[model samples]
Target: MTNPEYWYNTRTGEVEKGRQSAWTDVMGPYPTQEAARNALKTAAQRNENFDAAEEAWEDEWDDS
Candidate 1:
């Protein structure tokens, strides 16, 4: 199989192609290095979206 084109190293906050460390230290199969580097930001944005959606659902349920 082919190696990943990009990876985000959460431990060191670095983006690189190919393997750098074990799975425990990495987090990506992102299409580009820029995307890999922004992994945390992307995750935060998704988390915010999920939280907002949950809050909205709760509000709707409470209105019923």
Candidate 2:
């Protein structure tokens, strides 16, 4: 059997066993409850990393 998925409810800051909240108010289908619980932290880190990468890419192609 496959492992159950967990989701982080952004609206309520709760870790749910499945898609218990609206899609727009949830973070993910994490493999574990702990991972789901840290969803906001993970998303923030990912956003920071993505912004850094995008900045580097833009700098590489800057003509001025």
Candidate 3:
């Protein structure tokens, strides 16, 4: 029952979560949890690299 630490990357327009430091395979520390995720999101998006499911992208589609 927590905020789950989310980040919004302006560079890539991607949102990411920490999911816990251990499972995330991260170093000791970075900036704020939100900052860390934003950094990763920016990097991934810069390379056009995405790991989430295709269904997830459906929300971004415009039906209107």
- Each prediction's total of clashing residue pairs, residues at least 3 apart in sequence or on different chains, is 0, 0, 0
Rank the models by TM-score, top first: 2, 1, 3
The residue pairs found clashing in candidate 3 are none
For every model shown, what is its TM-score relative to the native structure? 0.83, 0.89, 0.24
Models ranked on lDDT:
2, 1, 3
Q: Candidate 3 lDDT, tens digit per residue, 2-61?
A: 445554444444444643334334432334665665565557675564545444576567
lDDT minimum window of 10 residues, candidate 2: 55-64
Predictions in order: lDDT: 0.88, 0.93, 0.50
CA-RMSD of model 2: 1.4
lDDT at position 59, candidate 3 = 55
Off by over 4 Å in 2: none
Clashing pairs in model 1, backbone N/Cα/C closer than 3 A: none
How would you encode candidate 2's per-residue C-alpha lDDT over 1-64 as one tens digit per residue?
Answer: 8898999998899999979888999988999999999999999999999999999999989956
lDDT of 3 at 39: 67
Q: Candidate 3: deviation at residue 30, Å?
A: 17
